[model samples]
Target: MAFADELKKLIGKGKQAAAQNSDKIEQAVDKAADFADKKTGGKYAQQIDKVQDAAKKAIPDK
Candidate 1:
């Protein structure tokens, strides 16, 4: 019933959702990375790749 409890519950729900939607989330990360690559003309390809890896890593396992 407290605010901290609500916040923790929300965080848990978010992680659960992330796990359930892992595939979709990965696709989104890839799409976003591709878009950035295109806009930058692949100049920041390495950094983009690193970010993509990091994003994927941030997703919790199902």
Candidate 2:
């Protein structure tokens, strides 16, 4: 589908950018997870931690 193709392209571009700026990406992930955790008052700590782990797995430190 066209939507899938476009999404793949965007993901590819993001991967390239992430490779160049892994630290910034990781920081952004941390900020976002922290924000979500704060918003939920630690109610979704496990979910946020899972998301953080997934993001770290997807975007390696390279």
Candidate 3:
């Protein structure tokens, strides 16, 4: 799968997992962003940041 697709899948899984665990969503997003940043060699930092921000906003508070 493409990087973006893979990232989306990871985020979806994280969201579901976070719904159950409640405390790991931020860490999951951070790890996803780190992976995306490293995979893209930081070339898409802005996009990754956007994704991270959106994830944070979407995740419900515990």
Candidate 4:
């Protein structure tokens, strides 16, 4: 699948699982951000951080 499609699927799963598995969702998002950062060699660190923050906000730890 395309990257955008894969990301969409991941976000969908994260949203669906947030209520019962927030930690797992957070971990998945974190891993995604880490992979993105590594792939970009930290060039988009700020944007990645923003995305990570949004993910965390969307699925707060319980």
For all candidates in order, the CA lDDT equals 0.97, 0.91, 0.86, 0.87
Residue 34 error, candidate 3, Å? 0.4
Per-prediction tally of clashes: 0, 0, 0, 0
Tens digit of per-residue lDDT, candidate 3, span 1-62: 69999999999887677777655778889999999999999999999999999988887664
Clashing pairs in 2: none
Which numbered prediction scores highest in TM-score against the true structure?
1
In angstroms, give how far residue 10 of model 1 lies from its true place: 0.4
TM-scores for every candidate against the unseen true structure: 0.96, 0.73, 0.64, 0.67
Q: Over the stretch 1-62, how does candidate 2's per-residue lDDT look in tens digits? A: 99999999999888788888998888999999999999999999999999998997788556
Better of 3 and 4 by TM-score: 4
Q: Where does candidate 3 clash, by residue pair?
A: none
Clashing pairs in 1: none
Tens digit of per-residue lDDT, candidate 1, span 1-62: 69999999999999999999999999999999999999999999999999999999999888
Q: What is the lDDT for 28 in model 3?
A: 85
* Candidate 2 global Cα RMSD: 3.5
lDDT of 2: 0.91
